[model samples]
Target: MKCLIKECDSYDKNQQWDIVCDNLWKLPLSQSVLMIGVLLGNLFFGSFSDRYGRKALFNFAPIICFTSSFLTSFAPNIYVFTILTAITAACIVGMSQASFIIGRIEFIGNKYRVLCVNLQEIVYSLGTVIPGIGSMADIQRTDQ
Candidate 1:
């Protein structure tokens, strides 16, 4: 369990992560866990929201997203990071697809609901791209 390879500016072995996630094999599993969490999120939060009301669920999405995202960043080990990542991924669905969609569609008239959904897609597309752009910029900055 030794990384005899030399370290670089982007990755210093002494500072890099250890204890449960020191290799690439677990990355795909972590990703799968995150994706699978969406199903669990929908199942759990969907019904919970039904009991509590979609508006309330939507309102909590920001807090859940922020808390999970923040905590995930601070995870000291791979297992903790993976679990928090799944929670964050789950909350992404709970916040947007399940809860907000339910709330917004309910608020809109049936006739205009289609338009609302379409607009939501536009926003979602932007959301997906903006992060990629930010990541690209970050890489470029780091390379500089």
Candidate 2:
């Protein structure tokens, strides 16, 4: 993203909009926005799940995440991209934690809860790392 931004002088493809210029502060701002969205999702959905049930939120969140993520891909400018990304991030957090994790723990035996949670986290970590590894491999291939 940093490379692309520099290559384009922060302009969108076809030069329709300016993303940022003179500095790259918006990158951090976008990340902070995503974190804020995650925090809000954790707070709201955690309680909402307790009240409404995990299935409702779990079913709903993915739809929102997919829609927002799809919209984000077509964002006309940085602000729009940031907003949609935040929404996507929040939905993902709500779906992954408020619904799935809680529901998984609740259905399992108490003695196994900790182990199950740890395993879940390990799987999630691997899911994250796999993409990074794929990107690294792509970079290496390009370098070669």
Please report the candidate that would top TM-score against the real structure.
2
> How far in Å is the alpha carbon of 50 misplaced in model 2?
1.0
Residue 111 error, candidate 1, Å: 4.0
Give candidate 1's root-mean-square deviation (CA, Å).
Answer: 7.1
lDDT of 1 by residue, 48-84 (tens): 7778877787788768878988998788776778888
Per-residue lDDT of candidate 2, residues 89-126 (tens digit): 88888877865666677788999998998998899999
Worst 10 residues of 1 by lDDT: 12-21
> Relative to the true structure, how large is the alpha-carbon lDDT of every model?
0.76, 0.79
Instruction: List runs of model 1 lying over 4 Å from the truth.
Output: 1-3, 7-15, 18-22, 98-104, 112-144
